[model samples]
Target: MVTLIIATIPACELALSDVFASLPDIEIEAERIVKGEENAAMPLLWVRGVEPDDFEAACEADPTIDDLELLADFDEELLYRMQWFDRIGLLFQMLTNANATILEAVGESETWHLRLLYPSREHLSKTKTFCSEHGLSFSIDAIRNMDRDPSGRYGLTSIQYNALITAVDAGYFDVPREVTLDELAAEMNLSHQALSECLRRGTHVLIEDTVLIGAAEFNL
Candidate 1:
């Protein structure tokens, strides 16, 4: 059975770590690959917690980013069409691998997390070898057979699951709100924006599985 692997890579090992470090307050989610070819891709990004102007300025100053164009703006988030000019070989290598499929990728501050589907353990082993040869730090966060987790019944990704559980235990969701996002993030060793994204996505998954799925089953 194909395995779903969730892994984290240090931003320092990636080409865009500096760009992410520069905008420490912003959260970036890869929405989709708008276009892709060998060694290059144009991805639509969802950015939050930064002003549009500030994001533009930061991009202009960051050497890793070739260009960024605002596609849409919302009160709390912005969509960007970004072009990465160089140093994308790692991603290209992953994409070109015949045994894996990249499902989700999000970056915040000093780490990039990716969810990938690998055809077998041998494929994953080869990927790890590839990363090691390239001096990239790769750590697997979770792994499950894709056939067994079609509905994500095990909950959110490991990081998100743990974050949400810790937050709840710490009273983050309580009416009085005992824990601040920053405090919780500190406990998890994650940036505030990253923690926020984790909580948001975790809650969404919980609701979808428990409430939405339940409602649909009964024709509610």
Candidate 2:
């Protein structure tokens, strides 16, 4: 079955991290990936809170960027098309080795929060193993079988959706805590561990899709 994963990778490990490290206030997203000669991966980027000239200066001094061009200007936001050097092999492996697709990527606070889709659970495992070998941390916040909607109705699985509703209706989210975790687990006919997973995964999905700052899906 196809799977959807929400994960985090440290920005320090990404090729463009050094380039944008100077612009800590800027928000960056991988808008889309366009194939170039020799099947090079070039990404159209949307960056906010930085002027194009400043961004240009940063890229010029960064060794990871092979080339860059400004594609549009929206006053506060600028669109850029850029190509990375061979340093971005990790990204290529995620895309081709496991046949995964990047749905979203947001850079902030020394981390890249990503939404990724894979053809199967095995593929995701392959990615994890690959990262382990490379000493790259692939931290998964939530994952589910993308059996119905790929985005999962605002990025939640059916189980997560139900879990949230059950928690809310049972007053699990109340300030005073109307229900205990164990009680909630019993109410849901799930083990305590299972209930914990549901709540944690569901909450992560809800926040990522709704309230996550500067989060956006990559344009396919």
Per residue, candidate 2 scores C-alpha lDDT tens digits across 75-125 of 988888888765566677888889999888877656777788899999999
Give the alpha carbon lDDT tens digit for every residue of 53-73 in model 1: 888887886655666788899
> Which consecutive 10 residues in model 2 have the weakest lDDT in total?
211-220
Q: Scored by Cα lDDT, where does model 2 land?
A: 0.76
TM value for model 1: 0.65
What local distance difference test score does each model get?
Answer: 0.71, 0.76
lDDT of 2 at 180: 96
Colliding residue pairs in candidate 2: none
Clashes of 2: 0
